[model samples]
Target chain A: MGQNYLASLSHYVPELLACLTMFGLILIEATYKEEEKGRGFFFLSAYLGLGSVMTFSFFSLSKPAVTIFTNSLVIDPFSSIMKVIMVLGTLLAVYITSQSKDIEGNLKPEFVIMATGVLVGGMLLSSANNMLVLFIGIETLSILSYVLASLRKGDDRSSEAGLKYSLYGGISSGIMLFGMSHIFGVLGTINFTEMAAALKGVETAQLAILMPSFLLFLVGLGYKIACVPFHMWAPDVYEGSPLPVTAFFSIVPKVAGLAALIRISHNFFAVEGALNIGWVGVLSIIGALTMTVGNVSAIGQRSVKRMLAYSSISHAGMMLMGVLVISELGTRSVIFYSLTYLFMTMAAFMVVSFVNDKYGNDHFERFNGLIFRYPLMSIALAVVMFSLAGIPPFSGFVAKFHIFTALLTKKYYVLAIIAGLNSVVALYYYLKIVRLMVLKDAESKDTIGGFNILNQSVVVALTVPVVLLGVFWEKLLLMADGAKIFIQ
Target chain B: MISLSSYLFISFTLFIAGIAVMIARKNIIAMMLGIELILNSAALNFAAYSRFVNNNLEGHLMSLFIIVIAAAEAAVGLAIVIRFFQIKETIHIDDAAQLQS
Candidate 1:
């Protein structure tokens, strides 16, 4: 009775505090003047961000780290690392909302609600030791995201994006849930560690259940990350949602979902349960297809968001390689890669926001003669594009190198070769964005003239992280190493 | 009081009906009802599965939470769909293709 009470208390406190703050922000926004909403949004995000950091710091780790929640909600170094990334990434994404005029009228507070909801989900997911908790956490994030994607209810494109996205999301969830049932039946446990232990002695009956369940889980995760074979909704959704929502969607959810993927794969599939060497072929084939299809589809895209959507799918492919490594090095590589990728992806989308606002169009050619027009934004766009293309001295390149080295160490020779070659293929499309911004002719001077303070601040804040992470990435790499030990 | 097979069969029947609703309905509200049906079937399954397999109440409790969550989802999803329909009229999803705002 006491334990159940404590569990309920432990579960509800954080969730309640988070939800109350979100509601309070909505109420506060009602009294807020138009000019005050931006600052209100910023302060709310800051409060939430600091609170999350404190929770992560106090609950999970001492100097070496604290304790956990019943040892089920793991407050380990690995979770700490992902939690920090999620909190910081979400903080920036929230601020991006304040700067953009994407949320019209009183609907702006909904962004706060949805974004905070996503953060809560991500945080819980990173800490989930029980499959039950993990499912709820993941579903919470997905449900909120589907709403956020289509929240621009006034926009037809937004509705389409929402419906397509929700349909796809619902199906994935169903498949995954079905798989979870099989897994639960086979292992007879909901706790991940216990499940892992049970998996060891189980016979073929369990394998039949385990393998399909694992596949279903991965399929659902794949949709969130927008990897190929399950990436169809991304282009339309990204293109249709408000720019800030797109930016938030691309980075924050991917990081959290991938973190869950890492935990699940490392805990269940990497060693104990059916993780024979043969699984390598499965990972390799999926990874190769994700990259190839993403790059190929992106090549013909005209819309910036559509292209970035495809681009993120390709990056998901790259992220999958780290999971395939399933080693401590691979875990570290994924963590490091995500940290860098967050900044670079944010920087790319910030530029997208600018172009969308200034010209009211996100078509690739809409950026004609951007270099002469908005010189600062042009440079940022080029840097993000080049970084995304894996060019040198950029964070994306550094992270890509880390993954390549990790894969090479694992001696997954084909995956290593495919990843390296795919990076080259990726260059063509990322360069296309850069080329449009830098070398192409400006159709009009309309986009370059105005520079709002909010826009300038967001662009600068996002850009600094990308370049700095690229230039001096070793310390971050060391942190990834720390987290890796926990995952492995 | 029911046999496990009958319970399973009933739940499966309900699940199939939900799938049919999901496939057959063009009305957004009806589709949501279909989702509720599907969730109800899952809840029934959980109770049945637990009775036959584990003899625990955890499954029953999870199904309860699942039903609660499905209610929340239906409320939110239908609101969004209704708002969308107001603007577009004729909530036939095929007509709403201006998806690049």
Candidate 2:
């Protein structure tokens, strides 16, 4: 038994290293004096730690799937790819925080520490294979995120964001637990493998209980991914929190939730049954509704940050469509979409963070005539917006194209139509920013202190993938195809 | 002797009451209590089901973890609530409406 545990530990190296990195960050933060502003050593250690984590997960991507920690957790290519994306998102958010003046200088290190903690939770969530681990992972992600949302101490808006997030989060998780308890009672197991095995033989009476229980389970995850009905906290939390926190929230938690959701959908619902039909039906309705509501709500938003929040909800809806199809093709497309979304969201948020730092607000008018001042940054934002709106010649378009293919394969034509229309609606708001940057006159000729050469280069570097992937996406599609969800 | 159905009925009542508290209560702390009620009801359900049906250890283990996690969640939730109170000088849930569009 001890030897078996050792073997499992060997496969768990990446998560262990990520935990160590978070601890190292805390120790480093402690050693810094109160008056110190730029803790260069702290950031250097953070970069090294996260870089090592990303490298380890990347190497593990091609290895065979292994269920570690006594079958409670999985280390698979699909999860490895997700961890890579989440860590990269965290790394980029940290870099954005380091450059932007949005977060107080003193509080910046705390952001790094909390973000690393959240990343750990995300990693756990993406790989969880058992009910207990999944519950723990979700709680870890939620608790740390509450602190991150209210990082601006004494700020009313920030505290309120944290409050709303925690309240809604608590209620949803509790409801999910109720659902899970009933499932455990009926299935006689919490391990997903055993549960799936048990599901094969359930009677109609069991099916009735299982269906609602699974929906309850979905409430927690859907809340994390910000789907409709469970998405009330998203726009408020996104707009109220600091920009870097918002960026992290959009990428890490959403991807982790989607990864878990895909795994669950693939595991238990892939087989034909009333359960499968019911689950897919519910997912389809939620997907279509989430897309329409998010897009329509975004059209009327004046705050650029809030608009981005709505747009992200719509993007999640699109990803949900991929999950509902319950095929390898659907899973692969979802993975590819998330990878593209990481770059587009990061680049867009970086620009917005700089703008918010300068004007103290992120309204549409703040971006007036940005091209004249910093054309590189302006062009990068435009590319990202176009990509986000699913225009051609961007990775966003390719990602959406793959999703459409997955939908058509399943004959979910109505969903495909809804998603296509949402993209067009998205274009109007996305292009509005572009128009403001290009056509409108500058409000002031003053330089934005946040857009230094280093920052501009980073923004441009991130945008490169958004444009390059649109044309040369076949290679990535091939890679995603290899990242099959390992079903035992 | 207490039956399984009786436990389920009690838990169901608690669940409904928790939801009612959350929906009807205007106080933030009251809402937090509602969340606690919901979590406890689930924990009770797990323990009941474990004792009555499965006879396995997983349900007991789940309930234990639920207890530990609920405390942690409450700690964070309360901290955020304290922060909200400090800023707004009120614990009314309506005061949290600043982010509403």
The numbered model that scores best in lDDT is 2
DockQ-based CAPRI category assigned to the predicted complex of candidate 1: acceptable
Per-residue CA lDDT of model 1 for A245-327, tens digit only, reads 88888787888778888888777767633554545556678888998888888888888877887788888889889888888
Sequence-dependent TM-score of model 2: 0.98
The candidate that wins on DockQ is 2
Chain B TM-score in each of the candidates: 0.87, 0.98
In terms of TM-score, the best-performing candidate is: 2
- The TM-score values for the models, in the order shown, are 0.89, 0.98
Score candidate 2 by DockQ.
0.90
lDDT of 1 by residue, B1-101 (tens): 67877876786677678778878877767777776766676667666667688776656766777777777666667767776777777777567566532
Query: Which ranges of candidate 1 are over 4 A from the true structure?
Result: A1-17, A33-71, A272-281, A446-454, A479-485, B1-25, B98-101
Worst 10 contiguous positions by lDDT, candidate 1 chain A: A58-67
At residue B14, what lDDT does model 2 achieve?
90
Going through the candidates in order, state the TM-score of chain A alone for each one. 0.90, 0.98
